[model samples]
Target: MRIDAHHHVWQIARGDYGWRTPQLAPIYRDFGVEDLAPLLAAAGIGGTILVQAAPSEAETDFLLQVAAASETIRGVVGWTDFDAPDAAARIDELAEQPLLVGLRPMVQDLADDDWLLRPHLAAPLAAMARHGLVFDALVLPRHLPRLIRLCRRHPELAVVLDHCAKPPLKGGDLSSWRADIAELAQSPNVVCKISGLATEAAPGWTVADLRRAVDHVRDCYGAARLLWGSDWPVVNLAGDYALWFAAADALFADLADAERAAVFGGNAARVYLRRRGRGGSRR
Candidate 1:
């Protein structure tokens, strides 16, 4: 199955999405499975991993409900208060829902870049590892070193680095981003997503504008460790789904078909759908 490994669906009135303001008018409206299914079909994508856009467990529950009712949503990356005292119990509860595959804390939005490394997070993180849940690192270039440390601390936890740490393609030198990403990739348990690059680039970006970062990530993580995601609706701010998908295809043109398949689908199935400790398919 060809998979778009990352994307989001939301209702505007949910009110938990504090970041979704009028400024992001292009994507500030509601987006649901009905809105995305046609685009997925148009791109020949068979399924998708629905990701959370808000920080509350309420939104996670909302997403789980959506996944339960949708055939195309294979898994969900939800959010929860990792620092909550009952975090482990909460994860255990969420894990009971088969579609819950991962968790993201919106690290990039926090004032403290090092917030994820807090000692309190250890227990919740351990629970995630115990359940075979993925740690979706929604971070920036500056967070890579800390992320590397986290990966070391929880070697068993599957970490998916979102958008190649949101490379600094829009501004400053990429030397720092490149070096840190290379180090992060050395952790075999971590995987990287080639998503959201278009929005990180200067507006009206072409395939060439993103090639350097894409090539660097491919070289560091290899095709097998890289998963392709559209980050749709969000992608609409830079370009539509077809535009980003086409650019991704062009950039990956030299890869063998099997390698492409892994990035587009196979890797996601292996990482998100197969539960650990539980010993069964999440599907």
Candidate 2:
């Protein structure tokens, strides 16, 4: 089953998604599964993993409700205070819902400097593994060492590196980013999103420009360790789901259909261990 493992849902009227600013106003309006359903169908995508963008627990419950009703949204990556002493108990409560595949800590805006590896963060990290939820790291390349340490400490947690660690591709200094990614990929526990590179590259970026960033991740992590994300409303900052998926087609062209299948969908099934929509096949 082909799964777009990462995408977000939000309602502009809902006082959430503060990242939607005037700069992003063009597409910064309301976007929900209704808007994306036909697009996913057009792309031949079987389902998607609805990721949380709201910075609140209320939003997590709302997302869960949304997932329960949307057949195409097969999984969800919600948010939680991983450092909260009650986090494990909270996650246990959430675990009753099977579609809650993981949690994201908003690594892009954290203040811990080395937050991912702090000793104080250990209990929640351990809690994630104990509860069988993945940790989706929304980080920049500079956070690689912190992530490596944290992942080593909790090796059982399935940690996904979102946005190819969101490289500074447009600026073209990939040396440190490349090195860090290669190091992180060495850990079998880590998987990467082979999505959102167009936004990481300069706006108005050509197919070739976007391909460079995709190639770097593919080369470093290999297709088996990489997965796809539409990024939906977020990807709209550069392009829509259709445009981003088009870029992926051009970039993933070198691989055999089977290999591309892994990056496009197979790896997603393995990560969350979802039943592929195609004949109940298991990864």
List model 2 lDDT by residue over 70-124, tens digit each. Answer: 8787788999877777877887787667778888989888876688876777777
Clashing pairs in 2: none
Give the range where candidate 1 is weakest over 10 consecutive residues by summed lDDT: 274-283
* Steric clashes per prediction: 0, 0
Reference-based lDDT, each prediction: 0.91, 0.81
Candidate 2, RMSD to the unseen true structure:
2.5
For candidate 1, lDDT tens digit of each residue in 1-283? 8889999999988899999899998999999999998999999998889999899999999999998898888889999998788998999888878789999999999999899789989999999998889999999999999999999999989999998898878766999999999999899999999999999999999999999999999999898899999998899999899999999999999999999999889898888877743222335
Q: After superposition, which runs of candidate 2 have C-alpha atoms over 4 Å from their true positions? A: 274-283
Candidate 2 global lDDT: 0.81
Deviation in Å, model 2, residue 170 alpha carbon: 1.5
